[model samples]
Target: MLIIPAENAINWKRPPWVTLGLMMACVMVFLFYQGADDRKLDAAIEQYLDGNLLALEAPAYEDYLQREIRFEGDQQSVLELQEFQALREQDEQGWQAVTLLFDRDYYQYLQDNRDLIWSVAERNQWSEQRGAIEEQWISRMSAFQLGLVPSDLSLYTLITYQFLHGGWGHIIGNLLFLFLLGFTVERALGPGKFLVAYLVCGALSGLVFTGFSMGSQIPLVGASGSISGLMGMYVAIYGLQKIRFFYFLGVYFNYFRAPAIAMLPVWLGKEIYDYWFAGATGIAYMAHAGGLLAGAALVWLLGKSWLQVKEEFFEPEPEQQDEQFTRGYAQAMASVGRMEFDLARRQFEALRENYPDRTVLLEHLYQLAKLRPDLPEYRDLARTLMADAMNRRQPEQMLDVWNEYLSKGEAHHPLAVEDHNRVLFTSLKNHDLKAAEKAFERMRLKAEPDMVQEACRLLLAEFEKLQMEPKARHYRQLLRG
Candidate 1:
């Protein structure tokens, strides 16, 4: 008989509803941030133009102005001067004239403000001090924000700073990381905890970006900071386990196992290497570092309970425990086969306690009980074994044992229905009316209709021989029914 393992029967499966809800929520948030970014671009154009710096760099400003003024327009020229001007004057009167003028004078605006865009901090001492102080306050306030730094820390900057992409390649890289790592972390930690972790990582990444690039006017953005944290948590929790990754490095699509603990260190090292030696043009390595740190710390804080939850919900069955029990039972049976009654009895008793439903174990127990029949304990053991057999729909087993006991004429034998009925039938068949009458009285108490009728017919015939006509008529009526 092939026994199916219980663990396989009850597979560890997660409910899809929770995952579905989280995915929907993340999509909605992404759309919201995208919308907010469009608004920030519009606001930045207006700020730049109102500052009267548009005239000197009018040609570049004009080019930025004509790109798009609405949400449906192309965001590819988001940083272009003409598009920026159009976005700024979108709600103003004579937007077409403003767009036309800015497009024409875009080159002049670039020439004038090229210095401001590149070195805004060095040119304006006040702006530098204010920006530095503002960033510092935001970083310090992070301890209280729990991950949500207020927008006033930087105007029109934080909006693009959160989602802006350095290039197509950079955005795609971050997106891939987010999709894979985010899904697993979200599923394991649940949406609420996952959200908290993401936000906190982002906040910390922002602080790191500010600290490392103090005077740089370059705006930071992308989900990389938060996604890095997820990677850290993944490594921490599944360090020993193999993670199947589909690598697309040029042509070869090979599968490999990354040692779980080593994943984070390797990732951090690459980010650091890129930051220092590879020109800080496309990616935010500092943000990745900050996010990784936050992710690792969060996991450390919640790792124990999370592990317990995973084990309780997803652990395989205790096959080892079952195997141990099977081994012990086999040894007990071997003892019984050798007629080591006492040792076999003890083992079988322990096995019965542990695995009460094993019918074969009870059968061996019955044999041991029979071997020590003179002991009062054996009599009780026999009753228990017979009752267990009956419960399991093995009445024939019980009947055999009862008949064996009766044949031995053991005074200590417990009265059983099968043995009682067997003796009653034998006495009645011999035509000893008085003995038959006594047996009939006892059997009538427990016998079904057919047995009662047969007994009554025999008794009636015997009573007729004794010339008891009234009793004979009564018993004949019972047989007719």
Candidate 2:
């Protein structure tokens, strides 16, 4: 089954810088650094084929296979060798010849018996040609130079290999997965911690691949393992909380809501099953599984105390509510167009009752409230608008509503302490220091000590950054108090 999280609305308040950086790193490494990979590989292959290494090795491989009868996949090797022999007799080396390099066991066997089989001069010449080709390949190809090779694994390869990819399809597919899940994960984890988590998961994936494919010389590359880790963290972060997931089984596909953590078993089962039965299809299912486990465990062990989850990231899915309300919303707007103010207000108020958090409704209602500001309900409507307007647009202007509601006249404020806190912090986060300063001053007298202190520190830091010494000094004095 193919399963993935149904997307939540993106919070662009904090752009996923780490995610974009990673995607760009992979792309640049591929386009500029790895551009020579194809040409270098072709040159190495051509050198090997032209030097008659395959022809020289085929007979020796057949002989070795005849004697070494018990090894796994040796029978396939025998068939492959016979095919190579037949092709050689017809004066063609064929693509099978190049692939023989992947069968390291056979390649090693040929090395071990080279002296016994080939005449000394021919063997020495072939060995020299092979050594040159190997050097050319390892030096010129980014995959070989940087990729994670289990047999010759290094601390360096564990990280660099993640940025290397096999081809356009490979990089494109990996990057697509990165963008699909990376942005949300990065925001949930925060940029610095998210970057750390990504590297940790990626390194763990490389280690896992090395554990399973131990002693194989083939280089492992691509970002799938890490991206898989992200998938794990994504599901784990939302553990036990139910969210929509898109699942596909053969011809059937649909979305269903289930506890987020429930996906762990299903995902683990799929990857493990593929590893067991897929017969070395070249995809690293083991690494994917490892990344999934690593991310889940890391996040779980850290928990909220260490890696505090932004609960807002997993808020109730708004699309469903919006979809259901579409008709009523249109009708309400139509009423407004015909000057049916009372009808429109009732319709919007009804919709507001169902979706109090929707900004569009609150924004529209705020405008309507301004039309009847003398009414007591207008104050309540304005308060609600300031509350929801924090993330979407300029919340600074909403402070006008707060300023209008009281005898305080932007001096001591009139909002409930909680709304006051929201307005202060949101303005600070959005960098409207003027709006934030008003909110902060209003809140300092009315808000909790901790909120006041945090708001004070945040405002002080921003003013300091902008080199507003007087403003910074005033906030700093408030912080000391």
Candidate 3:
């Protein structure tokens, strides 16, 4: 029932509020406004089935099916009608097989041949019965006005229908799609633009469905139209870029990497195929296809100005990058062996530009920067190496590099509050109490109060072990704070 991108996990640093908010809105609308709709519709239908209206309409409903068998000239329709007739004959209480709705055409059929069908009094009674049923249909079902009826759609109902749903399965499936596609698109376009685009696509999907099903009384209700647009926008934003996709093909569900743009056509084809072959399955397949088109077109029109694609979401795994650069890395190391530091530095710098998180590369650059602190790039490499306390492969070397740079009277960039706390632990790992003491003082500025307290406790214990009374006493005073 769904295909979604599984490229990026949730980043707590940037929560997708707009996506969550939209999901909440859909759920709340269903609970508060649409919840009673099902019960009300059932009440009206129950009344129709229990009353004389069923006796009158049952034969007429059968006549409508017979006409389909005679005129439609299709094996599918004929087979379906034959099944219906067979089901009725097989069951004793079989008249219930004829399900009735607010079918104006069938009502008109009854009225036009009133003499053949019934007497004047009987016709009047039939009219009164259907009239009473119609009244119950319109008034009792609370969500009837909110749904987008194709024959009599209003501007207000066009958008409102998207928020309304038929039942639990419909709303749950739709919200899952909204969260999956909406977050990335929202992160790209931002909240305001994402909301605008979502509404526009939903409206367009309604219009597209109306174009096909105009003059039909059935109301279209669900967020699928809007969500389909998000699917389109997702592909458009990452066009031609290879990204991991999780797909389901009826019996199969699996993931593979492909250009994100390629999925748009595949998704469109599925919806169009279902529309052609599924045959009155109640899903608005055309609306889904239209929404996908509208979403892609909106992003394409806005171009880069509107869509800020985050490359990290679609980039290859680090192992793939490592494999790609292994030969280049060997060449750089060969240059280092030949004492061609300038050429080696150039090659490492090039590699760092693409994969900055490569720890071995950074360690090599730090070593190179030590050999040539006179160069302008040493300051950048030194700052980069020291700031990332997360690169825990070589903490002793990093502290030594930091010390040499500062001892030479070079200006130091301050560590971020969180990084400063991490570096405190890093300094202690190397048994550099003097450096840990400096890190402790730097962290005193604005690090988490809890982390600072923990650091004081740790320093007190470590210094006491070294029989350094003055350092231990200083930490004791800070811990008291």
Candidate 4:
């Protein structure tokens, strides 16, 4: 059973190398080191099930069954002790009877001795299993050394335990979660801070688990603690923004989109419910819940930049200057309607100088250039805006100014030749061939000898790329002249 997020709630400026590196490390560790443990455990269990007495004689082999029955004991397993007695006292067929009983549906195993001890036979069987595991010290020694145990946790296991896993499924499930949410959190908080936060959260989650299961001897491993922290940060940063997720439960699978923050309650609720009712199923649900709380708290305490988060999740409103310029420009236009051209011109120029937003100022200048072309201020401002737009490589803005100039019937006006060439390049780049032709005409009429030759050469190159032979030939002839 897996729930995978489809997309991140935040976008990053660059690739998340830290997240990628962690994923690669997990894969390498699992492939080379952890896979061996999984294979050994599987083979040992299979051999034991086959009733091979020689297989059971392997050094510390009884430790596996002892650990399984101790931490993973249940009422059903207590009943299976009858068959174990029958096998030892009667025949190999008795072991076969118990093996068939073990094939029932998976049940959450309890650690309670009372639930597993109903009769003297069950009690003896449980005691024998516990003694056999304790007698063989070398069995699962590596796991015990690396894994985090609540009762006797070593200092190094705080970090090392997260890198270890009981099986391939455990490691892979955790890595999938880390990949999806880790990048989003890492992007929100930079790589340096994110790394620090992740480690701290995982340690804190372990401590939290220790507080609840203080006396338990079971060793906890896998990256769920750290990955859960990333999920917490993800919820904090994205909040109400909808994110997509894909979920699989055996053969039934589906994808859905929902608010990223909405998962917080659902995930927390499920963990809490499972921890309360599920009863020691070998899953560290409390660790996951702790990581969530720790991650969200860390993000809140560290303080994500509200502006940066909002930029990723929401659309920005219009700037203050735009609204102010619109209101002021309307007043200036009303003055022009009353034939107060001098007052209107004065107001427009004052507003243009006072307003810091170039976009709004350019727009006002365009309107003034159309209405009061006699004023040198209006025409001069238009030229400044056109040049600025060209330098900024803003084709739409240049077209706005050019169209305004043309709208006022200024066909023969002495605009700069460089400005004409800029408009030509911008128009063609925008795929406006008609505007490009108009700019070429203006460039030819106003350009000096040197400027004309440069323009012809540039246009020839551009037209050749566009595969327009006629236009290319026209520029070629111009270059020849």
Candidate 5:
């Protein structure tokens, strides 16, 4: 029968590179999904302009218009007008009965109406000039575009509209929340799952906002709906952990701990309070509430997996079995500090018997032996400890013991390196010549002139030693070159 140790049971920690790649993949997916829809809308608009008015009603017209105007702004005026003109021309072509059904006056009204045309034109111009400024401002608040009636199940407005925002403060605030919470949640969920959570939260929030607002024309923007999901995950995972918060009043700073679960209620309560009493100025409380609910549901579903991971990787190891030996060793150190050598020696010897495999303790035993070298047992013990320390890779400690032995004029063995070098220099000094040779080889491989020149001195030294007249003379000429 075979039994595996508890420590080897599971791996809960993900590699940092894996986490980073997941983040990049999430960013790419978001970009591609958003881009694909935009391209589809653009193509539809183009086809409508190319005498296909029947195609106009087939697509989500308002959504495509909103996304185009929001993203392209004034820069897209010419394209927008072209599409509009094509739709008009296609209406005259009778491609669809609805196009012909509209009276000449109504059709002319759409064509001659400068207000709608200018509205689109101005939107296009404004978007082109201030796309960056607008994006920056809109990233802070909870926002969503109008969803379809009845089912309210749609993707275009729900996805792209979340990327739009109301103003600078809203965008900054939302991005700040995302930056703070996103990294932690992403690390926990992996990139793919985190992104799925984000999109779901945004879609849910949009659905709720559309239901409540109905005819409201306010453009929605920001990443707050998704950030609320991260907040929910934080609460679920670290419910028992106390969160430290700081507040400043004039020159004084106050600090306190709010139980992790309590922050959710506090946050929700504030949003409710602001929505009812403080006017519709700061936050989108309804969308936030919707996002919070979605997040809670997601956490409940995934909490068990997260908990298992946490338990496996993060628990502390139990204390060592030889507690008494460790305590005696510590006490011996304390006795040594007080210069009670005899007491220290007695405590150390007792520790040595219990922890015979611990080489660190052996070094301490060697030092104690040196202080009492008059005893033959002390000398024997020191040599045994010194040899054990060297074998265990405690080189510095071994060197210290070796120096003490040398000073006392006792029989001591030198390390291998002491034969070639006068005294044992650091590993670097011994390897310098070898390193230089490798560097010279690399330079010759690359055909570098400076490398060839540097190798001349090394070559001359080797030649002088071997008394190779021809090779020495050749290196001499190369050095001059």
Candidate 6:
């Protein structure tokens, strides 16, 4: 079956370095070290086969003795033996020569006197082939020394074995699970604690396998135990939040969303059943179960503070509301384009309460504000837009908002003093002395000393052009101040 997790809600301010580092380490070890070992094993096997061929071609009395005993166990062997006897009757000297050399169990004789046999074999040039075969078997067995064997438990193997995978399929499967679930749990417990949890859980898994698989000598490897621990930690941290999972059962494939905590029993139970009741498939299912239990218990013991951290990461799926907003926004724009103002305004008003942060809704509201400044939503949108304009340094947009809303007392106050200078200069350029006077007064209230002096000089020039000496003298005094 296939199961995959969708994106989680946790937004890290930076990349999850610990998870990325672990992934890089695994890839490096597999590519450089474990891959070289595989090539060595293949070469050793080929050498063993070559040596065995040489041994087969070199006929010894030992071969006849072994074949004679093997012949008693099978009908084909018995027929071959009968043919040999017929050859003996036809050639007495040849038969006597064979019998003299193969009268006893030469295998036992070789075991009792290997030195004596090797001396005779060396004279016949067969000793070098035997030595090559033995060397090949020793070289082929060396890779297993890196893995953790229950019968020969060591602290180094417990940790090292998890990083050594048996094959590409094994490494790929374990790393896939690690990437899917490791980042989420890391975000939940933080990077430092996540590292601790991973190593400790892996160690616990190795211990469980050692205890149950007692006398077995087969070595265990791979990161399944650690990855399964992260899976358990994910359940504990997410609590009741529903997470979407992709699944496949042979011919059938489907997806389902369920609470993270809900899958714990099903996952742990499956591991337990497979470990105890199912036929052996060379998988250490009990170790996976132990890791899960250890991880879950560790998180639970971290108390309410960690539980609250989990709650902080809970973000419900936004798919439904986001779709609704999309459709509503399109329909509202359509109504406006059709010149149906009332319907558009109503649609925009409803959208305002629920999705005020949406850019399109705010824009539509700004349009309505331009036509009907009396509406409260229009004024609210004006303030939002004015602030946004100020942030973006869009002076013309701010001037538009000030004239359409703030100057008309539609919006209460100037968002910034630098904005008023633009308005005053604009009004003076338009020859609207009355509007210029109003903006100058507003500017004096909040303008900086240097800015106020600059505005006073402009007013002095405009007033002097109208031939108003008293007002020009008043501006001269203001500039001097």
Pairs clashing in candidate 6? none
Per-residue lDDT, model 1, residue 293, is 76
lDDT of 6 by residue, 246-296 (tens): 688899987799997788888899899898666546688988998888777
Best by lDDT: 2
Relative to the true structure, candidate 5 reaches a TM of 0.40
Candidate 4 — which residues are off by over 4 angstroms? 1-13, 35-141, 242-259, 304-381, 389-481
Candidates 2 and 3 compared by lDDT, better number = 2
In model 4, what are the clashing residue pairs, if there are any? none
Cα displacement (angstroms), candidate 5, residue 97, comes to: 34
- The alpha-carbon root-mean-square deviation between model 4 and the true structure, to one decimal in Å, is 12.3
TM-score of each: 0.44, 0.65, 0.69, 0.54, 0.40, 0.61
Better of 2 and 3 by TM-score: 3
TM-score of 4: 0.54
**Candidate 3: which stretches are off by over 4 Å?**
1-3, 74-80, 83-87, 90-98, 102-117, 138-143, 304-344, 347-366, 369-481
- The candidate 2 region of ten consecutive residues with least summed lDDT is 405-414
The list of candidate 2 runs beyond 4 A from truth reads 9-15, 63-69, 73-94, 316-481
Q: Write the per-residue lDDT of candidate 4 for residues 1-481, one digit (tens) a residue.
A: 5665666443454677888888887778667766566455444345444544222222122232455568886443454455454554565543443343222121112124324433565445544543343334314544666778887877788877777776768877888788788877776676777778888888988888888888666677888988888878787776687877788899999989988778877777888899888864779999999998888777677664531343433332245456777788899889978978668877887886766455665665566566666556555667788877777778788798877776563644556677678787788789887787788888788678887787677678878998999999988987887
TM-score-superior candidate, 2 or 5: 2
For all candidates in order, the CA lDDT equals 0.57, 0.79, 0.78, 0.68, 0.53, 0.69
lDDT of 5 by residue, 37-70 (tens): 4444333334333433433322323334455567
Q: So what's the TM-score on candidate 3?
A: 0.69
RMSD of 1: 13.9
| Global lDDT of model 2 | 0.79
Of candidate 6, the 10-residue stretch with the lowest lDDT total is 99-108
Error of 1 at 170 (Å): 6.8
